[model samples]
Target: MNSVRNPVLRSFCGWLTALLVVASVAFASGEVRAASFQPLEIVTQSGVQVFSVEIATTEEEKTTGLMYRKELPDGKGMLFDFSPEQQVSMWMKNTYISLDMIFIRADGRILRIAENTEPLSTRIIPSGGLAKGVLEVSAGTAQKYGIRPGDRVAHPLFNGH
Candidate 1:
């Protein structure tokens, strides 16, 4: 029986080790790029919280609003944008969790808040009046923090749409 070490195999192992080290360093330094979003964190007058929200500004995105998501992170929410402000209606057609939708004007002022919307219900949740943006957070979050019409949504994304 003959035992021999392959140089090619040794080189391959060294290259793999180097690649893994680079990847590890990138991850440790938070330099690893995410292929998808990490959920948005929003703060209202109530406090800081995290939530997973889908942004719906365009006709298409709004059509698919939070259809299949099952979990919602606390303090995180979605900002739906609309160009040329008008009344918007949202429904929990495919949504699996209850949400509180906060309607905001173009200036980021809260116009109306629909809280504790039933999940998977087709009930029409209207924005009441013209609004430029809508934020969806966990159920009852709006009332818990005293978020009401006229309160401003202080986020940089609220420029116009």
Candidate 2:
């Protein structure tokens, strides 16, 4: 009985080890990572719209913001924090879905809205003025939700929460 149980335990351990190895490889290859989501609000003239956005604060996360994704559902987005309020440039290199890039000031005001950007284009999308953050949402989100410049953004990253 002992010998039979020992062999079963060894096989189980081997299978577990293989699973862990595969998972580690996927993570190391940058193909899998947990996303951090937070609540964000846009106060438009019409009303306030809420979104559950993934925050990209780390350099690696910001560099790979929404890239390779097939779709971004409505009411979901990615927020990039570029603290210190400087000029920002973005491109759609590996991004497969069209997006609306909303430039935001440090004071949480919407500075500019670049809507309906072409997907997978390398063309530089520049923030016309200094900005502290940028929100990338599904194409037509600005129009559908009445989001515009001078609108207020309520997020923890911005001033006044």
**Candidate 1 residues 19-119, lDDT tens each?**
99998876455343213233443456676545555555566566656666666766666677775678888899878789999887777678898989999
After superposition, the stretches of candidate 1 with alpha carbons farther than 4 Å from their true spots are: 1-54, 157-161
Q: TM-score of the candidate numbered 2?
A: 0.82
**Quick one: best lDDT, which candidate?**
2
lDDT of 2 by residue, 1-161 (tens): 54435878889988999999998776555454326889999999999999999998888888988877778899999999999899999999988899999999999999999999999999999999999999999999999999999999999889976
Error of 2 at 48 (Å): 0.4
Candidate 2 runs further than 4 Å off: 1-35
Model 2: how far residue 94 lies from native, Å:
0.5
Question: What is residue 108's positional error in candidate 2, in angstroms?
Answer: 0.3
How much is the lDDT of residue 41 in candidate 2?
98
Among all candidates shown, the one with the greatest TM-score: 2
